[model samples]
Target: MTGEGIKECELIEWHIKEGDVVAEFDRICEVQSDKAAVEITSRYAGTVRRLCHEPGAMVQVGEALLEVEVADEPEEEEDAAAASALGPMPPVQQLAPAEQAVKREQAGLAATLASPAVRRVAREHGVDLASVQGTGPSGRIYKEDVLRLVEAASEEVPGPSLQHKLPEQRAEQLSRPAPSAAGLPAAAEDVIIPLRGYARTMVRSMTAAGAVPHFHYCDELDAGPLLAARALLASDPALGGARLTFLPFVLKALTVALAEFPVLNSSLSADGKALLQHAAHNIGVAMATPTGLVVPNVKAVQGRSVAGVAAELARLQAAAAAGRLGPEDLAGGTLTVSNIGAIGGTYASPLVNPPEVAIVALGRVREVVRPAPGGGFMTASVLAASWGADHRVVDGATLARFSNVWKALLEEPRRLLLHLR
Candidate 1:
């Protein structure tokens, strides 16, 4: 089952079927929804009685996923022990409201009931989550509750400062389906298709990301020295013949910059308080896959050389293309590098994926004429780098300074050796 408003999922593949013996924690099937592609595991050791749904069927969360006839020997006195233990306990009707709030069997939060998405929205609007009543499963605070409070607050705009309403307007616009040619004329046979799986997931995730205040910083780097460096590295047998691209160099330099300015390598805690500066730089690189786009990081790039980064990146790209990336591969992305240049874009304003304070878009290399250091005009290859950062955490000077470090390394490729380790 999926969380955060996902009530059902499309069965992508079933690893087990009718009469297959399953052990506890064994993966039985994989399902995809707007939230993610997850493997459903078995909780009991038993033989499957039935396969309720076929591949590609939509299954509800509350419905019987599959039947299990326990294969383990039963404990005969278990029912009697449970009844005797409960008989000595008072019912909830006899307890006070404060006393009733105690965890019945498991330890958890007292009354906090909001998903990450809901909590993020509430934090943005300065809504007190504790005061908002929850109406979802297990008293989870839904997105509607956060929006209700925001709308009520917007009703009291006393002056003509409409800027206060811009956030809501942008959110409403983003909520609509983005068509490639939205202004084109419609025909009688024009069909409206609903987003599913990866596309649907992108919409929801990006929608939440859109709520964040973002700032973009643009700069151009001379790629002349960088290209020469790549050629030199290509001849090294230590690279293991891994395909070398501009991304590895870009990522390698980014890590060097991050080591100096650790703030950019951090994420806000769940409650939107305190900063978590990660010791390891698990840098995520966006790659296209057979299923969709996946940003699996080259874990601990801070400790790897440029050649190592290339090798690790090759492995991740292969895994993504095969649809074999696990949850660990997809999660824990502290920062991301979107190589829009690979797909032929010259400039991009990439959105900052939440929990990641920053993202840099690498643009296609181009030839440009510039003044030489010795005074004559020189022709050089250049790449444009545009960075988008969460304004709540990153400021212009910090990002610019960080970019300068990255720029120095790329502009003068030999500088990377000093930080290569």
Candidate 2:
């Protein structure tokens, strides 16, 4: 594959070598971004044939990185039919269309030609590259063109491959059992889940959390004051570029409350009979990823300012989004905070993150009017916080007290800041 930006000093790494049979979406290489290394995944299923660029080489976006030899009998059949009907088949050439549309594009023009990645994808899905219209720089065929062509063709042509494969061939591939693990015997039937990035972490965490006895406590908090505080902060010149959300404030408040209620901040021992109270206050933030849920922690959040928290949160969110987090980011979390609000959920009793004493969920905020002390009514953001405590370690009274402290701190954020300092 092509690596455009690689330099003598700058390095890129290719995970899979040429001729390796890789599944679709497998990570094949990694490149360094400004912050960290980012992996590039395979777009199609095939056997790798050649590496167009050497590992650690610089590559451009449209340049061929590598070549894959995929089964293309369906396309071969279509090509033969076209050749017979058209007669003395015209040499493959390019065409400009009225507007950009896949399946109506040109093929001979180098600038309008599809990249190796896109070509492989198109071939697998039986997309006629010539039909797609180029929309890239100087009317070049793009990756998006292949996607659009495939989607449109899918609706028109239902099952082209169903007719190609024999029934016995399909059954043989389906019934064949996968090999057993090293030194282990095969089962009658086994379902194997490949451990990829996010899925891998989910398996580890879920397995660990299952050992603890979890008890959930959920409540709706009046977020009117918190929202008002955010508006006030956003208006300040010093807080410029800082769009205040309930999370950082909640984190600040929770950090202080966690300090007071040390039991909630402590983890249960693996033996299931003791507490492991930590000296430092590390908070894990649950983020939804393309594969699954991943909770990466921000170390010593109690020591950071509102702006500091915001910057770190943005960095972690980006890392989580790009699937670039390391093991350290997923470890040493004293407690977790899950914000399902982004997904429009009002409330969720989040499961306890392993080793941590509790996990708190912040649900969506909604406009609700409550009776005003001096007048008729006032509108405010009604927010919900769902807390899951390890019943073996923390009791209901301790949890109620912890919630009360957090409520007091969030309602009066200035006081929360004082405690943070």
lDDT for each residue of candidate 1 in 1-421, tens digit (9 for 90 to 100): 3555666676778898788888888888887764457777775677776564577655655444565666544452222111110012111132344453464223454336454445656765666676676654345456677778667767776543334334655466558586687678865632335456666667766897898899999999999899988887886888898988778888889899998999999988778888898888889988876556667888888889888999988888877676556667767888999988987967788898778889999999999899999998999998999999989899999999999999998998888888776
Q: Write the per-residue lDDT of candidate 2 for residues 126-203, one digit (tens) a residue.
A: 556667776643355666777786667667868645322345545665697876668876556333343444565577
Q: Estimated TM-score per prediction? A: 0.64, 0.57
Candidate 2 regions exceeding 4 Å error are 1-28, 31-195, 235-242, 374-377
lDDT of each: 0.73, 0.67
List ranges where model 1 is wrong by over 4 Å: 1-8, 16-27, 33-50, 66-196, 269-273, 372-377
Top-lDDT structure, candidate number: 1
